[model samples]
Target: MTKLLITLLSFCFIQCQGQTKKNETDEEKKTRQEAIIKEHVYDCADKIHYTTQMYEYQKCLDEGIKKDSTIAYLWQQKAMPYYKARKYSVGKPFLDKAVQYDEKRWLSYRAFMKCIFSKDYKGVIEDFETCIKKYGNSYEMDHTYSFYIGLSYLQLNEFEKAAKIFKQDIEEQSQRLGEGHFLDLFYYGISKYEQQKWEEAIVQFDKSLQQYPEFSDAEFYKAICLMRMGKKEEASLLLVKAKKDVEKGYTINEDNAIYETYPYKVRW
Candidate 1:
């Protein structure tokens, strides 16, 4: 960790020295600053660890970014430590630059950082909607984008809106992902369950369990649907199977509702 810290410090020193170029144009100066900021950011990123030294290293990158404020990716680099620490309060302001500059190939995957880490579901939906409205269909090509939006709506108890998006994705895909992602089906099932459509929710859960056989949560949800619809025997059997899965330590999305808590694991 000490070596990594020294390496990043040395990189910053080198950049400060190099920026003293003679008779550089204004644009050239900006470009040079951007390059220097990126250098320090990458150096810090490479050295990141769960250590105090690494936090100091990241703070070094953040300072460089703040000093060279025009560079979008620099701000993103500033946010790296916060993202890793699940500290969205400190990170989101920095990530704002990546969004503003449209250097967002990775940011597209990460809007959920706000939803999962900040409990900012409404903000997530509004931001995605605004961006998607501006960028249109191309902005939402990734399945995860749709999932996050729908899941946020679910969190808000807005079942109809959530169902609209999930149904579109599930029904419109060109090819099946064999059984498909369990969370995809799970969220869709949840939308139905929230709407009190017991039979439909059970069908979705059944399809999920068919593909993701060991998904205890899916079985548990299915049991709930059956129990709701007065199929006590069937519900009891499914609940027993789900209990065994829990005892054997299976896990899935929508388990503890921590994403609603404004602090979360980076992944769903």
Candidate 2:
């Protein structure tokens, strides 16, 4: 009876192995077919559509999905053309599906940025956290994810938490960029500004100016801090410099004038 039971278990294991092999074969075939469908879709869009509208892209995707719904990369690729064309609303749904099918880290980043563009800060925060979990921590990681997370929280009016996170991000950036990175100073200044730490913001703006003397935004913020601190004369001079530099096209960026309480023709 024991020998019979052992024989029965061996047969079941062999059957399961056979079924696994068959599943693997089918999966491989599906992958190959999806590749063919993606190539055809690209070709079809190129031949048939002069404008890569979302509907046209969706048609191509439908064709690919009909061939192999499991092809997540095909969905991702379909979204790419629309994203490149700046049809974000059209691409966003497909990108969401692509994540559902395959949650790759880079794709998560793409989705996070898409959500940011879409003004879905909550979704952006979630995706950014997922990215950090999958990709681990690093300089770009801290600057990109943590900074954005703090921004999202600030936008959502979680100021205390946002301030703490932003400070942590600035600290991480200082460690990574040796406290002298211009962008690091920008972020630090912005973080302090968000927290209403005008004095600290001024110090950070100064650091930024020391690194890049013509840093327009830093100068603008310094003027703002001066205005907040009731030093109108100094603020006015800085604002004048900002306006002159801007009018001369020495600083074409609109942020300097707009943020400095100076009138500008262009608003960003």
Candidate 3:
């Protein structure tokens, strides 16, 4: 541990020791100590964000990990820059350690990275399935666990499974949050499009567009569906609009889309 961390922890111990109450219960004392440690960890973490140098950042995380090897956030912090830089192989070991320390918190995030950054669709499916079994259909990075599973199945060309999972996710979200996310609806449409179910795909694409007006991927795919159904004139008009919207930067706006292309995100 660094001298600064050592000193801060020592000061916290001394301060907490001085605050002990005569009638304090064992659980109360434990809670108090945990709070002090958490605050000290946050204080150490605050300094990490001020530096952009990778070595310095990793060094800071190393110090915190040394102080408490059980804290998963330190390991995750150490791994993020590597993944963001497309160095997934270099980052995976650190991320695995984070998962080891806190599976519930970091497993879904690791699955998300595997889905988007590493292109490990099988691994993504396995990790997300594990997450769903343990946590029961949760959200990670703004999408449901099933959403990533659906995306992974799409990448693996398992369109039927992808569409099934997407439909379940849409229904669950509709019941829980009043509506499904636009990307969920859009990707469901892509699954239908892949299956060449033109009319069914068009219905999903239209619903997605209702949620996100001028969503280029939905518009583009809907136009393709129209053309497939022999509505050539209407398809041509919508295709032109889709191309113009995409040109104006109206594409997948997910935060990680800045780092990697999402599955089926239209570029043209």
TM-score to native of every candidate shown:
0.72, 0.66, 0.83
**CA shift of 237, model 1, Å:** 2.2
- Which RMSD does model 2 reach against the true structure? 9.2
Q: Which sections of candidate 3 miss by over 4 Å?
A: 1-52
Tell me the tens digit of each residue's lDDT in model 2 across 1-268: 9999999999999999768646777677776765666465656654555253657756766777876676677677676666656578887877777777777634555644443445567876787787778775432333457766766676676767766776676677677666645554665676677678899888877887787777666677788889999999999999878666655664423232222322112232
Pairs with steric clashes in candidate 1: none
lDDT of 2 at 104: 68
State the local distance difference test value for candidate 3. 0.87
Off by over 4 Å in 2: 1-53, 80-90, 138-143, 179-184, 210-213, 244-268
TM-score (C-alpha, index-matched) for candidate 2 = 0.66
Select the stronger candidate by TM-score from 2 and 3: 3
Off by over 4 Å in 1: 1-38, 83-86, 103-110, 134-142, 174-180, 247-249, 253-268
Q: Please provide, for model 3 over 47-116, each residue's C-alpha lDDT reduced to its tens digit, 9 standing for 90 to 100.
A: 5652366776676667666545766777787788899888899999999998998899999999999999
lDDT of each: 0.68, 0.65, 0.87
- Model 1 misses residue 200 by how many Å? 0.5
Better of 1 and 2 by lDDT: 1
TM-score leader: 3
The worst-scoring run of ten residues by lDDT in candidate 2 lies at: 259-268
